[model samples]
Target: MLKFTAEHEWLKLEDGVATVGITSHAAEQLGDLVFVELPEVGAELTKDGNAATVESVKAASDVYCPLDGEVAEINQAIVDDPSIVNSDPQGAGWFFKLKLKNASDANALLDEAAYKDLIA
Candidate 1:
């Protein structure tokens, strides 16, 4: 399932893990990315906590943890080439995989229509 936070983070949950990234709207707002810093594998993250950093030509922004979890993996491709995030924020640009502390917590996040309205 896919869920989104008001902070503009998206989470795709499958099994007990979630792949997290900035939404395309967020990427557009940040302009072209120049740097990305991901959390370490096994790092514990709390809901709404800073999970990663993305710096663009316009500004730097934090990618928040939409749900509490432990970092299971980080995408190195985006770190090596931040522009990938600009091109595909929801796909190959995902920042990390998280082992959710409570998968049910995702239920409280926004759905596609709600998120679209939020950004609209």
Candidate 2:
């Protein structure tokens, strides 16, 4: 299972890390994005803080960090092709994965059901 932010960020848990990205709905809202600013690997991040950037044809938005930890990896392919965000926001569009400093951070986010309600 995954959690989501009201801001439309999705978080997937795997091996104690949270893989994070914008939702398909968010990509749809942003329209055609032109650029993406990915976090550097090994960068320490703060929960709910800025983690990355998405520059759409309409506007540029910051991707919020879903948990506190060091960024373990980032998807470079998506950086080269930002449209991957719109095409597969949940899978290949995932921006980065963070090695959680505190596993409890998951409790602070909205579960899938709650998130669906938020956008509904």
Note the Cα lDDT for every prediction shown: 0.93, 0.89
Q: Which residues of candidate 2, in runs, are more than 4 Å off? A: none
Using all chains and alpha carbons, the TM-scores for the candidates as numbered come to 0.97, 0.95
lDDT assessment of candidate 1: 0.93
lDDT of 2 by residue, 37-62 (tens): 99999999997789999998778898
* lDDT score for residue 29 of model 2: 90
lDDT of 1 by residue, 1-120 (tens): 999989998999999899999999998899999999999999999988889988977678888888889999999999999999999999999999999999899999999999999999
Number of clashes found in candidate 2: 0
TM-score, model 2 to reference: 0.95
Q: Which pairs, if any, clash in model 2?
A: none
Specify the highest-lDDT model's number. 1
